[model samples]
Target: MSEEKERQAANEWKVGPVAFISLLVAILFFSGLFMKIDGMKWLSAFDFTTLGGTFGTMKEPAKNTFLGAGGVSAKAGFLFALSLVPTVMLALGCLEIFSHYGAIRAAHKLLTPFLKPLLGIPGLTGLALITDLQSTDAGAALSKELYDQKQITKKELVIMGAWQYSGAGLINNYFAIGSALFAALTAPVIIPLVLMFVLKFVGALFVRFVLNVVYKEDFRNEQ
Candidate 1:
């Protein structure tokens, strides 16, 4: 009985059934296997086209309207929201795989030095944060996951949120619409892009100061 007890204690750190299943689910879903399997066909119910159409219809004016400004806004918002789905899935899916393989722990050790001073978040969270710069939805989703796991506190969330929203999806959105949107600005568009990146970090710092100084929420101690 003593030997059995010792073995149980030794295996305590091994990956559990739930974690294994989570990793599997992340892999299957992201790889599109779930959609292919008839048993999991229901998962594909998250139809972006239908969702976008619904939003466009709902935003149509009360009076007779055929895709006017409101409809356009709705479509744009839908597409924008849809654009984030893949990034969020891919990032979170990779996170699950990394977590299962203990890569997150390794990454945390390596990233702590740089991320500690800049983001005030755990080294493990660096993956999500970087993904946020490219896709706000992915970043925000990953942030929520980290918070739910108790890896970060509410104060840290606020700081990351500020940084994310200030200039989230910077690269994708810029290349998608920057040219036509700022045609008159010409070469000066580069200035705004650079400023946006700078301001995101600045906003993060401001939030950190507010939380650390005013609220006395010290993340260094929390970690």
Candidate 2:
């Protein structure tokens, strides 16, 4: 009976991880397709004359102000893309600060009790799971830490990979790039965002369901 339990646990671990990674890859590929089809050329279509006057013709505009005495340059589109750089840099810096302070560890402890049973993951796995929601790199780093500590098995890592891939760091991308596309195309911004969220939610649930089905016998034996 003990042997059967061990086997079942192992199988459950394997199924979850495998399904997670596959779903993540699919989401990324589709996101790329959506971006390409949404008309990204608007970034280069700004006209400075429409704003007020040509660049360098305006009086000194304060750094914080968008418009000058002559008017704002027709660089709205370019400026929007440029804005993403600072946001990304800020996110990376914040992540580093969080890691330095061991904030992830504290978060893990706080989340572990609730998540461990539901996800069938180790207490520390919470850190990686939450980080995955924020950013893929952060999640990957956390996963590696857990793996190195022997806190999670190969199967668990695979599941984390799948989950992170699906929509990890997606919020930033949506606001930065996706929003830009919506503005350019004059499309209903809420629709695409909602659709993407629904797809990701459904995909994650589907993957979890498949894992449960595939490993049901093993899980039952474990119980």
Candidate 3:
């Protein structure tokens, strides 16, 4: 091969060390392999049943026999929020690694074409947005990491957060928690999930308009 050709081949972009690290982090996170690791087991130690029981068992303040409204509310709030702590911590840690390792930048260029028009955010945001549809805490945590890194502007943050709030946990919420309603009804489960997912994007458009035009926030620095 010619010298010039050899130089081009050597410099041509291929998966690098950072990309490998980022890929490993992503796989560990999404596959729940991190949770299985001995050192990381505490991250998944939270008990959903116990958290739910706190609210289920809560009652109005009564005489000495009852813990009262204050106690009930305190326990409920603490447990509910505590259940999400693991997700937030895990996502933040994994995303920081991904960001430092160049995963976000590698994904940005390819995703920009599609995500920009629909969400007014960079392509890198897709990972969090998709994860949100399964787990809201993890998604929000990832978005926060992006915002902190200044990869996304304030406007993009708000728009994406709104999208996530609307239907980010669709699969889990509908198939698991929402199964009570979906199973009892005659309607196909896909109907509500699909409807909610579409509406989420629609809501993103409105939010983008409000932030971009109404508020006049600049999101031109997306990276």
lDDT: worst 10-residue window of model 3: 46-55
User: Which pairs of residues collide in model 1?
Assistant: none
Which candidate has the top score in lDDT? 3
What does each candidate score in C-alpha RMSD? Answer: 9.5, 16.1, 7.9
Q: lDDT tens string, model 3, 1-223?
A: 6999988855543447776567545544453323334665565433221122222333533532234434466676777677778667766666676766766655564567988988888878876876686677778888887788777888889989989999666765676678778657777768877889899999999988887777773655543
TM-score of each: 0.57, 0.43, 0.64
**Model 1 global lDDT (CA atoms, 0 to 1):** 0.64
lDDT of each: 0.64, 0.51, 0.68
Candidate 2: regions farther than 4 A off: 1-105, 184-201, 215-223
Ranking by TM-score: 3, 1, 2
Quantify how close model 2 is to the true structure by its C-alpha RMSD in Å: 16.1
Candidate 2: tens digits of C-alpha lDDT, residues 134-176: 4455457667766776767665565566667776666556765
lDDT, model 2? 0.51
Clashes of each: 0, 5, 4
Cα error, residue 194 of model 3, in Å, equals: 1.7
